[model samples]
Target: MDRRDYLARLAGVAGVGLAGCVTLPGSRVTGDDLPSVRNATTSNTSSPRPDGRLPRRGEVTLPVSRREMRSPLTRDHIPAIVDPVFGDDWDGLSLPDDSRAESTTLPGDAPVIGLTDGDRARAYPLRILDWHEIVNDTFGGPIAVTYCVLCGSSVVVDRVVGGSTTTFGVSGYLWRSDLVLYDRATESLWSQLLATAINGPLTGTELTIRPSSLTTWGAWSAEHPETDVLLPPPQSNTIRGREATFDYFIPKYRRDSPSVIGFGTDSNGLHPRSLVLGVAHGDAARAYPFETIRREGVVDDDVGGLPVVVTVAPGNTLVAYERRVERQTLHFSADGPSRLSAGATRWQRSTGAGVSGPQATHDLTRANDHPPMFWLGWSGFYPETSVYGEDAN
Candidate 1:
């Protein structure tokens, strides 16, 4: 389906019932007609200043660019799905038996913790939730956390009240139940329409909040005018992207016999993440000659969005490497199937050449006689494969 159709599906999933409906203005255009629409030119001349500090908002990369990075694959090229797709379909997509241990979560909150405060939110995997999709959180707030799968741009939005938070998924939208601020003196999801206002100004029950039950689900699409909002299938931070301090890393394609996969993350968590995957050569400590792949701008909708051509870097290639907590481990297609152990620190070879690169699927469940799911986001080239998300298989 096209972006609009995909969005419509998401709206349906929001379960707006009769109250969530709203009349959309103007004739809706097909995905084909999007090309006719022109987008404004944006400048990327503002980089971090020489003071060794970060740049101002004008200096940072824009959200559109990050969208491009997340989808190096063309959206128009995506085959229309006759039926809705969920994250559970991937099975036997990775190495047979990986001996790798569980990767440790960062000290604070898990970087890609699932937001269980909603009906739909609770149904998807935490890793899949990492990708920013329009979901009605249990808090009754119709918000979206635009986390790119490749660039790792995570931006939370109230979509109504305009209340939002950057980097970390924070907003006026509570995680308990899907509710609007305007009706209950909190804030309306419509307030999120304030462009660039990631976080809105309002709090408590004294504020007014509305529900889709009030005006149908028109409030969601009305607020986000740029693109058709959709719900993402379950995925992982490894596939899409994840937020890190000042860094939004994204994974693209791999290089060299599908040995390594590429990834990039953004500092803004909403723009192109400058990362790639390739074979490691020259510098043992820091993988050198790392080939880069295009993560953003792969899609076609936004005109002035992601303009740079995705290519491999000139002198270096990236390599296949895994982080087992404090100790880092390197792997090769020759290393057999990479598997993860219970401890979450050691990766072992399956003694079988299963799938290699980021596309390889590893079964995470041992109950079904299937190995755990695992894939390296960093690889060396085209035709590279890696498994993404959790699966009982």
Candidate 2:
């Protein structure tokens, strides 16, 4: 199935709806009445399978997902919460670059942060950033902020945009627990899934911190002397309460094939509501809502880590086998089995399903000896397949 058709099928359900506005939980309510699937409390799955699916070697252990439970915060709670904030323009923002030699050092020459090219850089602290690597911090005005509580260093990215020079830090909404501060960018709070902390009610002095990562929170408290860090408050509503479970399986169901999992919700009886399946891989991160889906109790490794990527269509229960391509790489061919050929210097696609239709115009090339890469020759059935690679290389 093609991407457009695959999406149409996934969107067929009567109750489910896309989150149009990037508002927090309360502001926008989806119409879909998808039942809840209370399978697990978090994204951790384990089974005694012979197959090596989990992050660890043993079948009994699965990698925990990098997601956190989120509840809508009261207006009073949000005022002082230290979270990262974002700006609209990409160019105006100050981002880290190669010049950060002393500032971006790790514990043991680990190269925690590195410059990608002209402006962008990647920072990763061995243990500290791993536990709390990806966070959303807010920037106050003019200063771009990127602080690692674990590493105890925050860098201001130097960027020039719209005739104005700017700097940025970890956005408040980066899903980190700390309240990020920022300036001059006008907008509403955008939502993040699988974030470390969802900024909630702000009126009090108490900080709602989780038990697992006390050190991370402690560092945050030390840095912000002027602000108060709040702990996770008691859940007044069942919708926001945290629960735990072991195993959950969505009744072997199929609505549309080639539908990748979109955003999930607390709708299903499982811990995570349901998997949001879409056609084709584009904006895979933004395509599905991690917070909403973790509620349904799927295999922990499957849900938490989002390990497997399969292609299937409605009425067909089994997911089609496909290879994982980074992003932006394309392959086209008139002869040979349709598959994704990787490791090439340039993106050259070769492979057609040998099917006749406008959809057959796309190419696929198998770079391996396993199974021949096949493209379901209809857009209506499967579109969630990964057509475009990440960088388009």
What is candidate 1's TM-score against the reference?
0.22
Instruction: Give per-residue CA lDDT, model 1, range 86-151, as digits (tens).
Output: 332223223213313132221121223122232332222223233222233423444443332222
Please report, as a residue range, the 10-residue window in candidate 1 with the lowest summed lDDT.
365-374
Q: Residue 1 of candidate 2: its Cα lDDT?
A: 47
Q: What TM-score fits each model?
A: 0.22, 0.21
What's the residue-level lDDT of 73 in candidate 2? 23
Return the TM-score for candidate 2, rounded to 2 decimals: 0.21
Give the per-residue lDDT digits (tens) of candidate 2, residues 1-393.
433543344334211222111123234434342223233243222342466443331111222222321222222222211232222111232223422223321222221221122222222221222222232222222222233221122233322324454322233221212223222232112111111111211111111111111122222222222322211112010112321110101111121222224522212211112223322322232122222223321111122223332221111111221232343332322122222222332222211122443333433332211111112111112233333121221
